[model samples]
Target: MIKKLLLGLLALLLCATAYLLLWPVPIQAQVWVAPPAPGYVGPHAPNTRLAGLQMISLGAEEGPEHVAMGPDGWLYTAVGSGKLLRMKPDGSELAVWAQTGGRVLGFDFDAQGRMIAADAMRGLLAISPSGEVSLLTDHVGDSPILYADAVVVAQSGEMFFTDASTRFGAKALGSTFEASVLDILEQSSTGRVLAYNPATRQTRLMAQGLSFANGIALSSDQSQLFVAETGRYRVWRISTAATGLDVRQASPQAQVLLDNLPGYPDNLMRGLNGKIWMGLVKPRNPKIDNMAGKPWLRELTLRLPRSTWPVPKAYGHVVAFSEQGQILADLQDPSGAYPEATAVTETPERLYVHSLHAPALGWRPNDLK
Candidate 1:
């Protein structure tokens, strides 16, 4: 009888512990998904009709962040080793164009064939076809460009770029995003967009109060510019026309073009077919998104090392969308291309993808009409 009584007490104690552990929590339990297999296909349906989704090696020794096509038909890309590489169309030969003082992020070639780059540590840079590097601007107004992220060239020679965050540099991007959630919970702003004039060699702030201003792309007509606000999961369109500018009477009033994306959007480029191609570093983990509503949870996640962090398998995709924000196709790592594909640029013959951690470049040849 004594043994039976002891067994009953033990069972009751276990039930009490379970109740205490789960009673205080109001949110649902987070579900963890396993990482994708070496050759995992995405859940989203592929637009098979849209061709040119293959992966080709770019022969880089380190991570490549962005790719741009020059007027000479050569592919220009920025690698994590702080070097710019110029590769032939077939990815056969490569030449180190310029070695910046820091990591290079985004780049675009001007009408004059000069390459303009947004270097994370060295600020804005200009590279000649002959591989000479020059520092363009380091600051806008009095604030230094903490993390110059992306750049675009206009027909008039004006350059637009994003200073991703004032709180963190490019080296700490992962941490910066984590900090952004905390700041958002506190309702703070720490990002900006700037413009540089080549003729006068002047840099000035064009927009402020951005969560994390990223890729900048001008509209086909040059009447407006789209700035990717990564932290807020949206793209903001800033007016460039005289009428819209005059009405705001301030830094361009940003209008949301797309919001609440399934993933964090990175480098954006205008496709040859007149669509916007965006690279998603990773998809939104619902647990992380929910935690972002709470500052403390966001802070804790940020402190965790990337290796220990629980990431969803549904991340990593290159999405193509129309100018009006219609999703055209969702291109994934069909051949297990890259772990973290960060940027995409289209040339007359192919589409190039840059990986953040992978040592090589991925390419898919275009379907000739």
Candidate 2:
């Protein structure tokens, strides 16, 4: 009986090994050396500024991934339910502005007052003030805009946005959260940045080969573009005139403005007095970074249940920086009262906090000096 039990145990171990090594997963693992994560200290020191913010409930619909102020002086935010909600600056009189029938991760207003959105599932869209939605451009040449993320409109009326990943489009992957995990695990760097001209109706690729090009913002002069590459934990500054440039190949015009950030940076918003506010979605996970050099290990990790994955814990964090990469203010909530604080929109009265999975929109007084 003992001998038989030993043989059965050996067979089980073999089967487990085979399942890990030969499982047919969606991600095609790629090798890239991840820089060592700098755990929160110094400028990114932990705090409780985000712990007890006032919240505006969204009822069942939640996850305000991005929020912006319209020229009408109302606050507009895109929720997970594909509904664009408009509310007063004080978070009252909530009403549906429009629905995209798909997720809109980020949006900005064009010169004509049309709200241009980077919809993850539907591609780029333009929504008029009267709630008429139009498909701007779904494809750049033969390649479709996979994950149309954060967008910014130029003074020249051009639109620039980030395609978070080519391999895991939201339409195919079903969920932005799932697709993001897969792309980050694979580290294939299939992300790209593109530009569109409304006049000529032409779309062009500006830069490519980023792990996950998430947030986008143009410079004060509209000469340079700032992008947050989430998977690599860095922010890049790319020139608006750049065309077909490969940022991964160290394009001179495309420079790394901030390197080795302590967390995965999410959205970017211009604040008062030449300041830019960025949210850090999650603090870095040391385990994930340690396995960066081991491609096989990362693949094996994916084979495990997603709940068992080494995703970093949700720590509410947001920071304000200047054009020269100077850290102005850093806010944190180690208790994570408001999860996935994706971005911050500043007004004279209050600073609204956007989240990825919170039941409410949080806000604190714009009292940061």
Please name the candidate that would achieve the greatest lDDT relative to the true structure: 2
**Global lDDT for candidate 2?**
0.91
Report how far residue 215 has shifted in candidate 1, in Å: 1.1
Candidate 2 stretches with Cα past 4 Å from truth are none
Minimal lDDT window, size 10, model 2: 52-61
Q: Candidate 1: misplaced stretches above 4 Å?
A: 1-55, 58-60, 171-188, 241-252, 302-308, 334-337
Top model number, TM-score: 2
Clashes of 1: 1
Task: Please provide, for model 1 over 86-126, each residue's C-alpha lDDT reduced to its tens digit, 9 standing for 90 to 100.
Answer: 87877767878788868888998888788899987778998
lDDT of 2 by residue, 194-234 (tens): 99999999999999989999998889999999999999999
Query: What is the alpha-carbon lDDT of model 1 when measured against the actual structure?
Result: 0.69
